[model samples]
Structure formats: structure tokens, C-alpha cells
Target chain A: MKQPIGIFDSGVGGLTVYKAIKRAFPAENIIYFGDTARVPYGPKSENTIIEYSIQNARFLLQKDIKILVVACNTSSAVALQELEKLTDIPIIGVIKPGSKLATDSTHNNHIGVIGTEGTIRSEAYNKAIKSILPEAEIFSCACPLFVPLVEEGWLNHPVSRIVAEEYLNFFKDKEIDTLVLGCTHYPLLKSLIDEIMEHKVKLIDSADAIALHLKTLLPVESSTEPVMDRFYVSDNEAKFSQIAEYILGVQPTPIKRVRLYESWFE
Target chain B: MKQPIGIFDSGVGGLTVYKAIKRAFPAENIIYFGDTARVPYGPKSENTIIEYSIQNARFLLQKDIKILVVACNTSSAVALQELEKLTDIPIIGVIKPGSKLATDSTHNNHIGVIGTEGTIRSEAYNKAIKSILPEAEIFSCACPLFVPLVEEGWLNHPVSRIVAEEYLNFFKDKEIDTLVLGCTHYPLLKSLIDEIMEHKVKLIDSADAIALHLKTLLPVESSTEPVMDRFYVSDNEAKFSQIAEYILGVQPTPIKRVRLYESWFE
Candidate 1:
């Protein structure tokens, strides 16, 4: 029960969830893996996504993790069901948490979701929102550039603002009171998106919801003392450190390189 | 006199150059290496870029290449000098050829260049153009989304067109007479870019220039039949084949997976 929670994403985007978990459950130890070598899972096929997701979960399971969180939207959209069937531990994904938040926040049953192409194309958010609200009007846009922009540490630059404006322009004339930052990377661009939406729309970040869910799922007697956070990546430690520091607003615990399949989980 | 030409890129984007070379030469054998396992070298630092570039070159050198082409713009911008200093073979990058075309095609002295943030930030094309035609006005836009869109095989799709329009809008009022498809991946979206530019601006593809340069630099022998092309990568043969086929408009020759840095060039 004292084992660390395992969090994995295609890249550092999962740090949003890691940070949220740290804030909510300060004493719980965490093991995080960002497959920086093949970070963008959104554009890949379902089979490839499943293979990568299984590898990620297996890697975390080898770390003796109590739970696994697939903190990437693309993977969640395409491989969550298969991932759940593969592992015995609870496997959480960002889509449901984000979809729930959007459905709950929408006053007029109008929700806007922005994520990578894979997530949008999968209609994961749309399906979740529709299943819950039955008649919610869902408008989804794939802001593919947001990931690279965030990775480049350009959260609020002029170009980032311009791009956010261009992508959000699709929702300008539409009536949507709530927008779900469906992709974990989108949270880093919240300020630009919020500014473009005139600060009127409520933005839902799945990280917050996932952290709350994690708190409920874990046992009450879980360790409350600060514990070490470990980071693992498939490649490029220095670049990962730079972006990780920018995204987490602090230097990451030193990142260790692990082969994708060999000796990764254990 | 019989050694094959060596080309390498971070990923399938470099296939643009491979296709051009095969078409232009027909009788010249080529050895291509795509570092699909650790791609998107554009955003990485100079040190990492040099290391990856060197590894790629070493892999190709083992194939007995007469020349080396750094098909990636990021590598050309940040690592070309290092690569040239490290190797004995005549080395070329796509930047110079693309820059030459941009300078030659521009009538109004105004040219636009679009590429990844790494390419734009390095100012490789801008410097190349300025060094050649000091009086030409240059506008550079870092289009981070274009690469991912192309990789997603969304060329000519409505979404791809919309993103292209947003990225290309900066050049519309700049009075540019020429545009350089700075990233090798950009050619995949050439039709959309050409459409958005209203056919008024000439587009320069670096791949074509590299092929021409190779033709001039390497010994030319007209064989009775076309030469066979060989492809190699660090990982994922199936995905590479699909992407290669989509980009080349023809099925890729069988690709062999090779360990990235295990080979020694004698």
C-alpha cells in the first residue's frame, strides 16, 4: 500500500498530473516515466498505441507501483480500454476526468474540447460527455501545435498567443461556456487560451480531477511524509531536464535513462 | 568511384531528399538512415544534435558512402560545422541549397522561410540567404505544427489547410516573391502552401537542390537500368514503411533496422 503511484505520458506533459498528485497527496512517493524518445503518441495507429501503452504500464508495474495513470490524451483516447484489460492495478486516464469536468461545468450543455488529433478523432471526450449529459453539444478541435509550443517553453510568447488565437477562433462564434484542456500539454497554455476566450470560459484541466480521484482511491493511512520523486525517460536527458524544469516550475529530480523494453520496469 | 551517397535525417522527413536523389540520379546508389527512434532533432541543443548527427553519419559511412548529406535542417543548422570538421568526406546540408534557390527566385528581394522552431531560431536559412544576397529582405516563421501535420499524413485535409493558412498568413502581406520549404517535411504540404500563396510566390524544396548537388559532386555514370535504393532506420519498420509510402507516393524498398551507434566507419 506504500508503493509509489506510477505516472506515464508520451513526454513531460504528464508532469501536470505528477505536480497535482504531489500537491494533493504530499507524502505519497511517485515514479514517473516520460517516453521522450517517442513522445507524441497521438498520430500513431491503435495497435502501435496499445503496444507503447502496454510497455509503459509494464515498466511502471516493474517499479512496484500501486496504480498506473496514463497521463497522455492520445494514449487515453486510443489505448485506455486495452491497457485496463492488460493490467490488474487500477489504470486511470485523463479523458474521463476532463470529460466529467466539462459536462459538470457547462451551464448550457455546450462544451469545447481541444487536444491532439488522435484524441479529437477518437471522439473520446465526445463519447464521455454524451454518455453523461445525454444531450451536451460538444465541439472538438485538435490544436496539434500546442504540444510542440509547450515543449519549446513558449507558454505565453507572442507567437504562442497568435497560434492560440488561430486555433481558438473556431469556437469564437460558438456558444461554449466550458472548455476542457483534453491534452495534458494544453494546461501549460491555459493563460494564452484563457486570454483569447476573454476570461469568460471555464477551463477544465484533467490533472486536478485525476489528483482528486487518486486521493479517493488510495488508502487513508498511506504515507503523509514527503517522499522522493523519481523520473525516467527513453532519451535526451538534458533537453528533458530543461523542459521539465520549465513545465514543473522547478528542477526535476535527476532523470535516468531506461531502455524501452529491457530493464525498464524492474 | 563506386561508393554510394549517404543521407540521414531524424525521421522519414528526409525521405523527401531520398526521393529527389533517386529521381534525378536513377543510376546512383543511395544509403539512407532515418533515426526514427530518436527524432525531432530540431528542438534539441547543439551538443545533442552533434552527437545524433555524428551517429547517423557513422552509420552511413559504414555503408561505404562517397558523400554525406545532412538531410535534416536542424542538423544542418547546428551540427554541419561539427560534422564537416569530424569527417573527411565532402559534406552538404539542405539549408545551402534551399537558401540558394530562395535568393535566386526572389524578384522583389523579399523571401519567406518556414520551418521548425529549431531551424528558425538557428537562423540558418536567413544567414545563408544574407551571405549570398545581402540586399534581400527575409521573413522567417517557425511553423512547429507543419511537421507533425505532415507526419500525421493530413496533407490536403481541411484541418491541414486551415493550419497552413494560419501559418502562411504572415507571408501574405510581407510582399515576398519566394518561399523556402525549410523543413524537409514541408514539401508534403506543398500543394496547400502553394494554394495559400496564390501561386504568386515560388517555392524552393531543399531536397531537389541536394539531389542536384549530389549529381554534380558524385561521379555520374549512365547505367542501362535504374539503381536499387536501400533504407535503414533505428526502429518501427511497419510505421516507417507506411509513412515512406505516403511521402514518396510509392512503396518504400524493404527497410532494415540497424542499431543506431554500433557500427564503426573504417
Candidate 2:
């Protein structure tokens, strides 16, 4: 049996990353977890985020997966190191790949990053981008409202447009050639964001970056059958599936409810 | 020393209730618990909410509180019955008092209630209003964006005004004479909500109603000294205190960090 790759996020926002990964590796089995009961990890404290991230990784690790993916940007920013230290399995996060994409896409060294408060506060993107393009200047904004707006599915709504304009207007005078969609949920607001930026700035979606990164690291398994990807959420399976359908364009099957605090090994 | 009154919510939104209770019983000590780490319980399932509510109640009960108050309307709606079963101390929730206030103020018995998805979905306000005024007509809308907007401190922002109009416009043709601010965080948007309703509808703030309800139920203690109110939050003490100060008009001192799942009694 092929070992399933384990992917987890604070909530369904990570489905974007899941979609990208699936497109890249259609034959590999994937197990996905969303901590919907305690989501929106964006504005939460670092310790709390770290604790939740560890719990999520433990849950995924119990499946005997070959690889682990931290799909949530907040968790990627704050808890990636702790998660890396917890297990011997190869762990990948969204930040470095997206940062690499930003550095490659930008003509000028100047780039803009927008994500949840937690991600921006951690300065993960700023540091990652600066490491690659040593002379790069990163202008990052914590667009806390963006996640909620995206969750509300107001993607093309007038209010979303107004909010996007208000947020993206920060980059107007920055002379940035590329902007990174630092959070997974942000890809849904791409069209609106592009319109707001007047299509001048290249937007780097972390989902695409992480998927491409996985392609280079993992061998492609040859299989003709459709993949049976398992899904789990701490709470609200229906809402998760609904949002998953909206994001992935296919109804996710075999989704189960899980209690992460309950030790899976025992 | 008198036994302190306990109030708990999923997050800082309940500070509105805490402020009201403090104003009503200045001499009585109050203990508030905000489950900030796993907040925005509005979108979670009923079972998860009940589980979280029980955990919160257990934490507060360990402190020997004389009375328990469920400050969150979502909790008040779905978890109150479970919480009432968990404790013998007198329990007060925001629902019944606000329902009574709305029933009393409506001239046409047409009322509109707006709150989180969980609160609006529970139909607690509908049932409560119907029990009192059998002929009451209730129109409820789940204004999920309002809480985030309020938390972002965009109370009077143009985007807030536009969003409010979209939500409150549901009651336009319903001829609702009264509107109930079903969630505790809603009072901060009082002026914006009022304007969206064209100042024609009477808005029932649960904070004031809950305070009045507590007044009739409890005897006033005789004390000239300032009452000491202890605050406990599951996470992000800084954000909680910052928001608390904004809602209460006074900085909350001696706010402690707590782990609700760690079993305080054990």
C-alpha cells in the first residue's frame, strides 16, 4: 500500500493547497484534517498556535504518513519549527515556496505580502523573501478582514471589492512588481485583488508554489485509478464539505469527525 | 467575602455583558472567562458548543461563583440548557431578557433579530418572543460579518455602513418595529445599525436587558468600596484586555491566562 501524505490546516482554507497538491500528484493517497472547531488561528497568540499545530501534526502523524504539510499560513509562520522538531518525517510549509515564487516573479526586488495578522506579525514571508533576494524590500500588511470576507464567500461582492481596494491600496506607491497571497484562503479573492491592483502586480499564490515544491521533492507514482483522499474535521463536517466543494470544485467524499485532543495512538 | 458572579463567552464580545452587569451591580464581584483560543463559536456544531460551554462552566464553578451568566447569545441559545443542568447556582442568559425587551417595545409585534449564524440558527429569540407575545412576528438574519467588522473597530466605516444596510434591509418590508442586538458584540455598532434601520426601529440591547434581569433576581450588597472583577482568558490576554478596555471604558486589571482543557480541579 502506498503511504498517504498527511496534510492539515486550522480549517478548510487549506483545501486550496490540497487541490494544488492533488493536481500535481493524482496517484498518491492524501489524508486531510481541518481543525474547524478552533479555526481562524490568524489573530491568536503564538503559544496557542504552536500548541494547536502540534496537536494537528500528531493527529496526522498517527496515520503513518510519509510526508506532512502545514497548509495554514498562520501555522506555517508560527508553528513550523515546533512541528519540524516533533517528527522525523519530511515536513513542508507554505512560506518558503511562496517566498521563492515571489522572488522569482518580481522584476524589481520590491515585493508586497498580505496575509492574516499572525502570518504578517511573524514576518515569515519578509525573512524568507529577504533570504533569497538579499536586496529585496518587502511591504507586508496584515489584512485580518480578508480571511473572514473570503469565508463569508463575498469573493466578488461589492463590499469585498471595497475592502480589497482599502487593503491593496497600501501597495500602490510601494513599486512592488509581485505580491504574495500569503494565506491559503486568499487565492479565492484573487480576481478581486487583481482588479483592485489594476492587474499591474503579479500575485503569487502559495498553493501553487507548495504544489510545485512537492513535485520536485517527491517521485511521481504511476497509477490509473482515481485517488481516494480521506477527509477529517474537528467539527462542522457539512460546512467543511460545503466550503471544500466551493474551493476544490468537487464534492469531497468520506469526510469524518475527529477529536484531536483524544490521543489517536491510545 | 461574597461569592463572585461568573460570566463566560466564546470571546471578548461578552465584555459588553460584563460592562452591563458591572454597571448594575457595582458592589458585587464578577469573574469573566473568555474562551479566546477557540473562539467564534458561532459557526461550530451544537455538540461542540455544548462541550466548550460545559468546559467553561466547570472552570468558573471551581471559583465558587454564586451566579452564572451566559453572556454570549450563541451560547445562551444552544448551551444554556446544558449549562443549567451542569450547575445549581442561579443561571442567567441574554436570550429571555432581550426577548422580553423586544416584545415590550414592538408596537406591531414585528421584531427583527440579527446575530451570529449560531444564534440566528438556534431560533432561541424566535421561541422566546413567541412565548411572551403569542402573536409576535419575528424576522431573523444571520449577520456573520458584523462581529468581525466590529472587532476590526470599523463601526462607522463606510464598508460597515454598506454591510449593515445589506443585512438590516431584510426588515425593510417586514415592517418590524423592534430589532434585537442578539449578540453581545453588536452594541458597539449601535449607531451604525440604527442608521441602517433609518432610526425607525427600537433596538433591544441584551446587555441592558440582562443587567435589569440580574437586578430583579439578586439582592444588592452594601459596599462603598470599588468591586474587584477578575478576568480570565484562554488565549491572547493582550487582545482581550485591549478590546475589553474599548467596550468597558476602563482597562481590566489582573487579567490571567488560563487553560480551560487542563482540568483546573484535578
Candidate 3:
């Protein structure tokens, strides 16, 4: 269990999840893969999503990670079940942990989920929440612009505030007590999202939820040296590093650009 | 010359180009492919962009197209030269046609180019403009949100106006007379963009430019029956059709989902 934890996302948005995991287990080394080349898995078909997820998993397994964290909400939503069947290793996805926390925290039994179009369309959050609290009412919206806005480093820009208001207008009348930040890139906008949703709705950041769950399972192991994290991306290392620094406040070192060989998808 | 004209884009953005081409050559059949799965080529690296473009070209060549149309700005920027080497058929890219039109349309010799990060970063329009007008001044910005905004079908949404204002504020101080919509997707936002630019700056849509260029090169042949069109995508046909309908005002017919067979990448 001393091996580094493997985390994968469609793009740099997953770096937020990696940062959370690192903070929770300071001494555990983590390996992160951002598929920057073929990102925005939100609009793609299910077969393509599953194929890329499988290929991503295979790439991380070759790195000998102890556990696989599907940090991407779209991937976790569409490919997690099939991915879980790949190995005996504890393969965890953000949807379940976040869904569980939302259900547990909600007093009104109404939860709001916001993610990429593919995530909302897949009804992953809806299904996960229904499985836990069968009687719970759920509201979901696809906020596709949020990812690009975060990538543009416009987290607090005036335009972002306007976009936030328009997208969250759906939840205003739903009487929801908890709102799930369904996309990994979303937690970066927590303050903005929280402000728009007002003080009543508890924000359920999947990154934080997943990090806490991992900590409980893999209690901090003693390490003599500081934990060193390895970074890998399918494309654009510089852009990835720049965005990583913007979101994580720390630039990942020794970043490597690795190809998810096409044959792996076959 | 009777072979169906082949056109490909990173995604539905190319449908704009397809529509423009069909309008120019009403008697010529067309074959179009949208790589919806691995789209937004605007954020990828040069090597990855070239690789995917080559694979896409290979995939379309298998269908025996007469000429190849690199309808994607990012691909045309990074891979056009290599793509030209692959076949004897005249391979044309939007950059040259659009650049030529921009240079011809400019009154002050100052031009503004707007596109994805990859396209702007590559300086395709800058080079194309400079190649013809060595002293042409170029200002470029990457409007990453426009694609998602259009895909969300928020054509005239209030938030879209705000995002446009933020992205286009760069041109306020510059004395640019011509604006190049470098990415194919930008054409869909033409009306909003026109309103924001104060109706003073001439907007150069690369799709229309490319369409006009193709007409001059591939003159319409006389035909008795109406030309038939076909569409293909690497992923989700339904979403592609939805977005295509939003932009094209008509759903493209006989759409099919085709795989870019892994071997094509090799």
C-alpha cells in the first residue's frame, strides 16, 4: 500500500482533486494524469468516455499505483462501474462519496447537482443520490461554461459572476439544502458558487469528500522524506502547469507528457 | 471532380464550414466528419494536433474524397503543411483563405484575430496576414467560452453577451479595422460579436472565406438531381445534430458515428 495513489481526469480540472488528496495525506505520493489533448469529456459519447477511461486506467496501472481515483466527474459517472471491474485494487470515483455526503447532510431531502453536460445527461448524480435516499428529490443542471471560465483564470471576473447567476438560477426555486460541485474544476469556484447559492445551501465539493474518504481508508503512513508528487498529461504540459499553479497554488514538479497509446483503447 | 468534397473539424464547429461549402456548391455532394470525442483541438500541443489531424485525414481518405478540407482552425494552423504532403488532391485550409480576406478587408492595416488558445498561440492568422502584408499589425485573443456557449444553445443569452465583452475588450484600444473569426465556431457567435464590435470593425468569418475560395477552385458542375450530404462523427451523433441544428438552422441528414480506427494514428 506504499505505492503512489493514481488519479486521472479528462484535463487539469482534476488537479483540484489531486491537491485535496495531497493535503489530506501529506506523506502519500500521488500520480496525476490529465488528458489535455482530448478533454471536455462532457460532450462525448459513452463508448468514447469508457474507452478513454479504460486507457487512462491502464496507463496508471503501469505506474503501479495502489488505488485508482477517477477524479473526473464525467469519467466517474459514465465509466466507473466498468473501470471497477478491471482490477481488485480499490477503484473509487467521486460521484459515490460526494453523493453519500450530500444525502447525509441534506435536511430538506432536496439536493442540487451541477456538472458537465455528459455528467448531467448520464444522470450519474441522480442515480447515485436515488440509490442512497430513494425518496430524495434531485435537481441537476449542466454548466458547460464553468470549466472554460476556470481555465481562463476568470474565477472571480465579473463575467463569471453573471454566468454563475444564470446557471444556478435553476436551483434557486428548488428548495435544496445541499449543492454538489459535480465537476472537479468546480471547487475552484466554491466562493462564487456559494455566494450565488446564498449561505443556506451547503456546498458539497466532491474533491473534499473524496479526500476525506481516502484518508479514512489509508490512514497516514509514516514517511521519512517529504512526499514527492509525479505529474503526467496526455498533452500541453506548460498550459497544464500554468492552470495547476492557478488552482493548486503550487506547481507540480517533474511533469511528464505521456501518450495514452491508441492501441490501449483497442 | 465529382467525388464528394471531404471536410473535417474537431467537432460541430465544422458544420458551419460544411453549411457554407454546401451553399457554394449546391450540386456537389459532401462528406463531413466531426471528431466530437477528441475535440477542442485548440488546447492541444502541436504534435498531438498534427497526429490527430493526420489520423482524421487518413480516415476521410479511406472514403475516397476528391479534395481534403481542413475545416478546423487549430488543425489548419498546426498541421496543414503536413496534411498537404499526404495527397495529390488540393488540400486547402481556412487560414489562408480567411487571412487573404482579412488582409483585403482591412482599412488601417491593423487586424484582430480571435480563436482558440492553440490557434492564436500558433499565430496561424498572424503568419498568414504577415506573409501577404509584411507590416500588418495583428491582435489576437482566445475566446474559449464561445464554443460551450453555442453548444449550450445560449445564442442570445445574457451571459453570452458578458463573456463576449470580456474576451473582446482587447480590441477596444487597438486601431484594428478588420476582425478575423479565426475559429470555425466563432461564426455562430457572429451576431453577438457584431453588436459588441460596434458595427465599425468588419468581421471576417473563415467559414465564408473558405467557402468562397472553394467555389473559385472547384467550380460547380451541372447536375440534374439535388446534391446529397452525409455527416460522421467520432462520438455522439445526437449532440452533434443538436448543436448543428442550432447553428445551421437545419439538422444535417444521414449522420453516422465512425471510429478513427486506432491504426490511422499509427
Candidate 4:
């Protein structure tokens, strides 16, 4: 397939996944849709999330994407199955890759998962880890502020370190050897988290794993042409550009602003 | 005198002021606009914020508001002056009232202010306080997590308490006699903050101060009638209703969804 892969997230956090995909498959064009207008889907109802997920998938499909990546943990937890059913293209979510990494990296059979409240409440990571290593003890905490901190570009601030210390203190006594960065945004705070854990805990970044998975799924004869990444947001392009620049280490391509209600998917 | 008062916030956080205004001036109708569709304005740039603030003001002015309140601290700090120029109505920002309270309530003259990054970076409260009491010692910290936590309705959760403790501990050794809850959302975390401070620090809620200021500005004849409150939002009425019910202790009136860009202020 010569078309780009469609990646969607609730907000800019998915840029983490987009960067990983670009790194792993340099020739594969990428189309990213960040529903920035109504983001933080973590606390929204399942039905509303499913509707949003479907809308996101529809928007991606309109861009002639060969595959779909639900880069948001909240949507992946509650809306992935429905998304798969609604779309014909190969669909991937962050949960499976993260779970596998956690299961493989744990030396003590104890794993810790940290994500948004919706992701933690869904127990999706727990279920995914258990399916692979049924006896693995999974402890999950919802660090809701992590996403906003990353969005605000405060990834390495002293306050970020303080927040990491307070949240990670729970895993210190739990003997968990592997910690899953259940949300893509969590990976941006990896340095702070690692410093707090003193390099003793292995942090699993789902974005890297998902990118690896995409490499295997692509057809052998997939287009070798240089890829182009396009960014679209519902509102505030300049702010999005600033954060995107911080996360991706480069200013993203000109972000096109589109009204959600008027947007149509193929 | 016949026009309603207009208030705008990034999200539901400003409902605190909306509620307070309703209670303080019974006859003065309110028109509240919450940009829930694209919230957390604290992280956006000054230009983008000014554009959004103007758009919000235009939306409310189309509803014939006599005055405008920049209830979101971030917008007030970064875009209030720009908004004032865009509209002819009397404009009020929460920062001035908030700083006055911080200066007046402090016994030791060592006061602390906590808010979103945009607000703190603008130093609006610090400037406002210094303008009044040049000798008062002011300490400011940005508690960026408080807004998202309040939006998630995690007011009294143990984790919320832990986060509050982590954020508030910065003020513990500073011996500040008064603390300004610089963001409207911070007031919702008062119980947890009070618990963390153990009643040693008095908290200044800008919403209350703004309400009193609005009362003083209201026409005497307008105060005789019963108040009517109207709500407006950019998106997700149901989610807004759920959060408003929790924070306001009553169900919000049916919200009117407005296309802010197309609305004419004049």
C-alpha cells in the first residue's frame, strides 16, 4: 500500500506515537489527527468516546490511510474493539505493545502501569499483561496531571520531578521491576521518572513498541517513497505548534485548522 | 442596565464566579461562556489567547452583555487588555480582586499565590499586589495540575489530596500568612488544601472577591429582581452538565451552543 498510516489521539500526546512511527518506518507517510477541540477523553462516557473514536477513524480513513493507530490510551481502552469493527483497515492501539513489554521486562513478576484515570479504570493494561503473563501482579495508578504537564512543556521542571516522586513512591515498596508508561505522554516525562526511580525500574514506552509492531505489519512491497507528515487540529494551531516542536524536536508542518462539525471523512 | 454580565473561562472553572455573581446580584442576569471544547488556555501563547478571548467576548456581546469578566486566570493575565480594547463594555479580571485579597488578608505580609503557568508567568497578581502594598512579600507558584484535577471532579480523592500536599508543601516553610487560589479551579480543591495547610494559611478565592466587586458595581434598581443565569459552551453539553452539577451543587440550565467565530459582538 502506498498511502500513509492514519494516527489519531485525543490531543498532542499522540505526537509521541507519530514520532516513533516516523523513526521506525522512515518511508511511510503519516497523517495525524489530534482532536484538540474536545480533548482529555479520559473522563468522558464510553459511548461518547466511541463516537469520538469513530469520528477520528472516519477522518483518518478520508485521508486514504492504509492503517489506523489509536494513539490515545483512553480511546484504545474503551473504543478500540468498536473502532476495529467499524473500520476495514488494519487497526492498532498502544495497549497490547505496552502490555507485552511490561510482561517481558519484569524480573519480579510485578508490573506497574500509570496512565490517565480512564485508562487505569478500564484495567486494559492489566488485562493485556495478564493475558500474556496471567500470574503477573499488576499495580496501576492514574497520573492525570502527567498529560497536562507534558502539554504545558513542563516535562523536566522541578515541579514535574516532585509530582513524579509523589506518584512513583507507591511503586517503590511494591517491588515492581517494570513500569509501563501507559499513555504516550508519560514517555515525555521518562527522564524525571527514571531519575526518581534511580534507574532501578525499567520503563516501558508503548510508542516505541507500537512503532516496532507497525514495521512488521507493513507489506514487503510497501511504498519506499519519502514520507510526508501532515498535522490537523480542531483549534489553536500556534499553541499546538509550540508543544509539537518541543515534543518532536522540530516544528511540525503547518497545522491546518478544521471545525469538527463541518469535517467530513471519506 | 438591561444587558447581562458576560463571563468566560477556558472551561467549567469559571462557573464558580458565575454562581457567585448570581448570588450577589439577584436581578442581574448572567451570560457565561466556557470554551470546554478547547480548554486549558493556561498553556497557549498570548496571541492565541487574545484571539480566543476576543472570540469569546464577541460571542457574549452578541448576547448584549453590559460588562465582561475574564474569569479564567490565564486569559485574564495574558489577554485582558486586548479583550478590553475589542469591546466597549466595562471589563473586570479576577487577578486584581484576587491580589487585593491576598495583600489585605496576610497578617505577616508574606503572601503566596498559586495559579496556572500563564498566570504566574504574567505576574499579574504580583504586580497588582505590589501596586497596592509595596512592602508585602509575595511568593508565587504555578499549580498546573489543580485545574485538570478539578475538571476530572477528583476534588476529595486521596490522590488529589496527595497532589495538593505535594504542591502546597512548597509554601509550608515560606510562612506565608495568606495564599491566593489564583485559578478559579483551585477553590474546588480548598478542603484538601486546607487540610494540607492545617488552617495555618488563609486562602483567597478570587471568585468570591469578583462577586463582591460585581455587587458594588451593580445598579441599585437592578438588585431588586430575581437573578436569572444562562450558560453557553462551545461543545459537549452533557459533560459540562455533569461537571457543573458536581461543582455548582445544582444542575445547570440548558446550555446554548454558539459558534463564537461567526457571532458579532456589536
On lDDT, the candidate that comes out on top is: 2
Q: DockQ of candidates 1 onward, in order?
A: 0.14, 0.42, 0.44, 0.15
For candidate 2 chain B, which ten residues in a row score worst on lDDT?
B257-266
List runs of model 2 lying over 4 Å from the truth.
Answer: A224-226, A260-266, B224-226, B260-266
> Which is better, 1 or 3, measured by lDDT?
3
Candidate 1: tens digits of C-alpha lDDT, residues B18-93? 8888788778888888877666776655655677787778777777888898999989988888888766989999
* Candidates ranked by TM-score: 2, 3, 4, 1
Please give each candidate's TM-score.
Answer: 0.71, 0.97, 0.93, 0.71
DockQ of candidate 4 (2 decimals): 0.15
Model 3 clashing residue pairs (backbone): none
Tell me the tens digit of each residue's lDDT in model 2 across B86-111.
Answer: 87899999999999999889999889
User: Could you give candidate 3's per-residue lDDT for residues B71-176 as a string of tens digits?
Assistant: 9999999999999888998898999999999989998899999998889889989999999999899999988888778777788898889889978999999989
Candidate ranking under lDDT, highest first, comes to 2, 3, 1, 4
Model 2 interface CAPRI class: acceptable
The segments of candidate 1 whose C-alpha lies over 4 angstroms from its true place after superposition are A220-226, A259-266, B1-7, B29-38, B45-70, B74-209, B226-266
- Taking the tens digit of each residue's C-alpha lDDT, what string does model 3 give over A1-266? 36899999999989878888888888898989888888888877889899889888888888789999999999999999899888889999999999999999999899999999889999999999999999999999999889888877888999889889988998878999999999988988999999998878999998888998897779786678767788888788998888888878878898988764341111
- Between candidates 1 and 4, the one scoring higher on DockQ is 4
Better of 2 and 3 by lDDT: 2
